[model samples]
Target: ALDQEKKQIEKEMESLNLAKFERLILEKQFRVLSYLIEDKKEKVNIVSCDELNNLLEVLEQKKQRRQDIKSHLDSLNKELACSNFDFEKAMLYRDLIDSEKKRLETVNLSIQQLEEKLAEFERN
Candidate 1:
């Protein structure tokens, strides 16, 4: 029964309407970061202040999206609680979702850190 509940939650999360936009934003930001890194490979000098500013904006937006998804997941958890649902099988699915969230959070943090580093570098 627990397994079934978790699967249900998984299905609901998977079907979340907002996930599509969230994923698109993430992918777009990731592509920009890739291009920035690639551009750095061709230049010997430091990156421009404007470039750093642009990247900071992108990172901030990405972080905001990450936070939004997290909040949505939290809301889903509350829904699960109110439903008084329990299932052992769902535990595995729940763990998977938690792990994926953690991974995305880690990436978000990395992006924030990189942005901070770039800001500091540009300041000097």
Candidate 2:
């Protein structure tokens, strides 16, 4: 019957659409992963759920590192504030604080970029 044929065609079209959508998601994941792994030389063919989980883990580690650097910087600031004498020690603390600040900035930028990429991937 024509009705049966039409129904079969519709089911095939639905299946094809689902497959296309899944492929699109995988492609997006691959692109995001590639961007995140810019420094690595390994070639990535397909992105999997495990890769996304790894990305989340990396993001969390970066956040923890940022917090650690912030706390260390605070301690250095307190030390610098309390030390009225020993100019060399104060200068050393200042240098350490400066380096920590720079590191924090780098981590913050990295986190921002990752979040933006994840958001974009979700949106698409």
Candidate 3:
């Protein structure tokens, strides 16, 4: 009985560790999503005071981000189509995808405005 109890305890510890690891992964993923959505992922460049260069770099990042978002959304949709569909998770991904597209729109607008300003400056 003592040996059985020890084995049970070990199993419980392993399950607890797995749960903790999963929670940490979830937290990290959410943090990444938050940063990507908020345009805060590339802050180290802003410290250099090169607004034009930084803006261009940021626009490139945003373009890459839009591609990533679309891929993720596609994967989520594929998952939703599987035999074991997770409705809640699919809805969550849908919402994130919508927000990501909105952010992309804003980024595009910002890039357009910057290009217009540059053109105007060059004209003068």
Q: Which candidate is the best by TM-score?
A: 2
Model 2 TM-score? Answer: 0.58
For model 1, how does the per-residue alpha-carbon lDDT over 3-113 read when each residue is reduced to its tens digit? 466467557656767654365344445534543453353232324443665666556655765665566567546654665435853463365357547756765776667
Clashing pairs in 1: 1-87, 2-86, 2-87, 2-88, 3-87, 3-88, 3-89, 3-90, 6-90
**Model 3, stretches more than 4 Å misplaced?**
1-38, 41-51, 84-124
Pick the lDDT winner: 2
Candidate 2, residues 1-124: lDDT per residue as tens digits? 6446646755665566465335434433443343345313112211334255555666776687678768867876886787683776566567667767887897799788767766766677
Model 3: per-residue lDDT, tens digit, 17-109? 465335434543653555454465445554565466665676577566666656655654564466353676556556655665665576667
Q: Give me the runs in candidate 1 sitting further than 4 Å from their true place.
A: 1-50, 86-89
Evaluate residue 58 in candidate 2 and report its C-alpha lDDT on the 0 to 100 scale: 60
